[model samples]
Target: MSRIGKQPVALPDGVTASVSGQTIEVKGPKATKSFTATDDVTLEVQDGVVVVTPRGKSKRARQQWGMTRTIVANLVHGAKDVFKKELEIRGVGYRAQMQGNTLKLNLGYSHDVDFDVPEGVTVTAPKPTELVVEGTDKQLVGQVAANIRDWRRPEPYKGKGIRYKGEYIFQKEGKKK
Candidate 1:
């Protein structure tokens, strides 16, 4: 049996969940999100709780059940509360700013890279070198943060560029004479 898959997902007040076909719809006070189950997984809602089960006694089905359940749980939680990702810009001349709904980054590039913030997601720069990404959807929030980080990933030599707050970068030594 799958430990995570067998766990019951509790529904918070003002949140509603329903299973139709292979789709699980969760509606909260703030927003609503739907997730589709894979071929080897099944989703069911009972008495205000959601359950995930494998379709058959196969290795693939077993593997998917737990993962599907976790995704569904995240969706439910996201509908109620926002998820956030924080990044810091290190090195001279590295900075970020918010222009309306777009994030403007200066990462040593000749031209600034402008990233558009999608609906339901907000990007804010508390300080020129600190950025915060907030949204209800976990996946979307994380993906956007990753995209920004990819624009100018931190280098080992100088530990410069964008990186998650408190993330450790292994510094490389200079070449031997």
Candidate 2:
């Protein structure tokens, strides 16, 4: 039995969910999101909750069962509330700013790195060294943050780079004398 798959996803007061074949649509004040599960799983809305079940006892069906349920839950949560990811620039010269729809970054590179913000996600530079990514889709928000961090991943030498907020970097000993 799949623990997560067995749990019903409850719809909040202002949120509504609809089921059509393999697709489930969740609508809320913030946004509306839909997900289509594989044929190995079934989707249904009962009362104020959404349930997912396996179509068969096969291993693939069982795997899809839990994954489908979690996807539906994410749709519900995303429809009702936005997801956010924060990043911090740690190097001395590293910084970030928003120019129109682009994010201009100075990550100790010869040329400033220009990151074009996608349509669904919004990137904001609250401070010179702080960046906040927000969107209705959790995956998009996280992916954008990760892409920004990839430019200058935190290193152990001096921990100089871009990193998620509150992320810890284990510093290694400097070159032996």
Candidate 3:
């Protein structure tokens, strides 16, 4: 038996989980997430807890069972608690602002970069340099944040660019005169 797969996932208050065929749906107060299990994996809900089991005894089945369970658990947690990513714009003139559903970034470039925020995600700028990304889906939120940060990634020379809050960029010493 797989260790992670054998463990039961406890459903939090105000969260609901349902299994139908190969699909699992998790509904929470904030949002809902759905996942489809592999052919060799089976999901069961017992006494408000979710259990994942493999259909047959095989190495591949064993490997997939635990992975599927963890993915489902993440989906449940994400729907309830959500996920967030914070970014900081460095440099003198670099800044970010929210214009309707789009994020406008001024990263010392002649033209401002505009990014359209996808559905199911929210972006907020508490400060001109600070950006907060929130969404129920962890993968989507992270990808969006990475895309934004890629516009002007922090450099090792001067470290003037966009980066995650609290992230450090190592500075290199200049050549001796």
Q: What digit string (tens of lDDT, one per residue) describes model 2 on residues 1-177?
A: 999999999999899998888888899999989888899999989999998989989999999999998888888899889999989898887889999999999988899999999988999898999999999998889898999999989999999999899999999999997
Residue 27, candidate 1: alpha-carbon lDDT: 96
Clashes of each: 0, 0, 0
> How much is 99 displaced in model 3, in angstroms?
0.6
Q: Write the per-residue lDDT of candidate 1 for residues 1-177, one digit (tens) a residue.
A: 899988988898889998889998999977899988889987888898888889999999999999998998898899898899999999899999999988999999899999998887899999999999999999999999999999999999999999999899999998999
Model 3 segments beyond 4 Å from truth?
Answer: 1-3
Candidate 3 to native Cα RMSD, angstroms: 1.7
lDDT of each: 0.91, 0.92, 0.92
- TM-score, per-candidate, Cα-based: 0.93, 0.98, 0.91
Q: What lDDT does model 1 reach?
A: 0.91
Question: What would the per-residue lDDT of candidate 3 be over residues 1-177, giving only the tens digit for each residue?
Answer: 888998888899999999999999999998888999889989999998999999899988999999998888888889689889999998999999999999999998899999999998899999999999999898899999999999999988889999998998999877889
Question: Of the candidates shown, which would achieve the greatest TM-score relative to the real structure?
Answer: 2
For model 3, name the residue pairs that clash: none
The collision pairs in model 2 are none
